[model samples]
Target: MSTQKKAIVFLADGAEEMEFTISVDVLRRAKINVTVVGVSLKNDYATCSRGVKIIPDVKLERNTFKAEDYDALIVPGGAGGAKTLAEHETIQKLVMEFYEKKKIIAFVCAGTLVAKAAGVPHKHKVTSYPAGVREQLVNVYNYSEDRVVVDENVITSRGPGTTFLFALTIVENLIDVETSNTLRKEMLTHENL
Candidate 1:
């Protein structure tokens, strides 16, 4: 309903610190109103994979919010983060609703499970972390085993090691490629975005 770039990220029990922070900060830098919504087991701060605690802007269990409040939902990857996200019925439902509307949804690293559980990619191109997890990612498993995958409104990136490029790709997804490239050029001297 509003034109503001309300981007909400789901921070479950163990999100990857880099994936969560990089995506949120870059989106904010690109002028999106980013909110870290914690999906905690007990309505508390989210504990990242790196052990850093993030106090959320909102708690999914305690709030009555619209999936439409945000234009996109970013799910960061971590062993526990992805597993926890994939198990949540509400989150999976919201993700499906967003995808059904053709809104943007992104998952980086092991978070790939959440996107899949939400049913975003039936057979489209997608990506995820390339370790033992690659074999388990949903759909197009053989396609993005090595690179960042962008299939229309659904974007996927490798992992925290690729956080910079991943965040920039998300910026490209929500805003425009030109803006993403410009920021990349500005951020990295030798970068050819």
Candidate 2:
């Protein structure tokens, strides 16, 4: 049987380009099977916050996407994308199912807000984009200013600037520290400013 770890990243209109792409790129490089799912009712391409258009591997459908099939769930944040994800009932249900199954759930920037709206059990150490985002998560979680915070199955990060670390953290969780470090060095991520 194949032992590859599988991950699913949910994308919505206005998703932060860096956050969504970086996470998927890093995971794929680590040999993890990453599926990009566009969470839209229309089943079309998702437009990023910076205006980059990406066609997802599949469109998220209520009965089609199963949480148990993947090892992790990723949500990349942009103000509009996060809001859309938070308000999407199908996405919320998937988040809850992932949480219940104890699978890794990673969120970046405003993406963490979707977890809040999904009602994933709170009090975990988490971080997200500051500005208008921190206030909402601070009271609900053991919030931090760290670039990446991993508490059990939930992993979160700050914003675009922190996407590398966030994605690397997910790699470490789904794979191993050795693999994560290898990719970090190969990508010269350790030398980033």
Candidate 3:
């Protein structure tokens, strides 16, 4: 066995650039094998919310994922991207598979809606942007105002402002506290964070 950790980040048009890029950057910094996947039918580049065009490392195909091949799934949120993700059955299945396997499933901003749609159980503690909105969340999970909330294998964070914290938390989960802290110090990931 290679013993290398692997993660997949799914991207749709209008995904929040900061959330997707920062989290990927942090994970790569920790030596994780991170794959950026485009969700379009062609599996091509996705235009972000800020108009940043990103070419994915791969394209996701329905019924083709072997969930056991990866250690984590990450979803970055924008209004349009999250809506698209929430409506995709394949993405939903992938999310649920990761959850069922007890692997890390991380979401940022409205991406939390994707988890809700996938029926990923939460321990009544999760966070997302526009904190008061709970309409999308089911009765099983309660929303939190914290920057990032980790309930077992499910990790959630607020908007772009907290992307660093979100990414660092993921690093801690996949690697260790010492590595996460060292990266935090090296990156100087904001004074308040």
Candidate 4:
């Protein structure tokens, strides 16, 4: 078999540990290459909200994502990480590049803010953790208000409570459902999601 395709998880100072790791881990377990990218303010390793420091796989200046390098962009939610990512000019540019090129964009938890800042316009439906940042996304429909809202190339989920669902949803987008289902079983996570 060929080597798995890759997805990138953008991180920064204060990335919520679980959101960051679980997102990357789920994709990895599904046999996709997950690249954890730490967009540090100091241009070095980023310290997670839980205190785990991670060295990014590539730097802002060195990334050759090209909108065709692999598959998707994953943004995990954390108050600090989201805040940092939202404020970074390079990240904004990269994300905009991703969006303009129609790459799959996945955000969970607070990561929605980052995506919104990159100009997703909230066109379809979206969900976010805590529900306070709805303003960032111009036209959002709460999933809990009804069903899981997936629009075009964008995917958003609530919070830690919805992380598993978020991961599976992303997998379904990046690859095949059979692969996603097999990995879901291996992780012992609900496929009903």
- Name the candidate that leads on TM-score: 2
- Whole-model lDDT, model 4: 0.76
Candidate 3: C-alpha lDDT: 0.86
lDDT (0 to 1) per candidate = 0.80, 0.91, 0.86, 0.76
Error of 3 at 15 (Å): 0.3
Candidate 4 or 1, higher TM-score: 1
| Cα lDDT of model 1 by residue, 1-193, tens digit | 2365777889987889999988888888878888888886444788788899888888888786566667888889998989999989888898888787777888899988788777665676788887867777643443566557778778888898787787787777778888787778777822543
* Model 3, runs deviating above 4 Å: 41-43, 131-134, 138-140
lDDT, candidate 2, 1-193, per-residue tens: 2599999999899899999999999999999999888887344788889989988988776438777899999999999999999999988999999998999999999999999999988868999999999999999999999999999999999999999989999988888889889999999997872
Off by over 4 Å in 4: 1-3, 41-43, 61-64, 135-148
> Least accurate stretch of 10 residues (summed lDDT) in model 4?
140-149
**TM-score for each candidate, following the candidate numbering:** 0.90, 0.95, 0.92, 0.86
Q: Evaluate residue 180 in candidate 2 and report its C-alpha lDDT on the 0 to 100 scale.
A: 88
3 or 4, greater by lDDT? 3
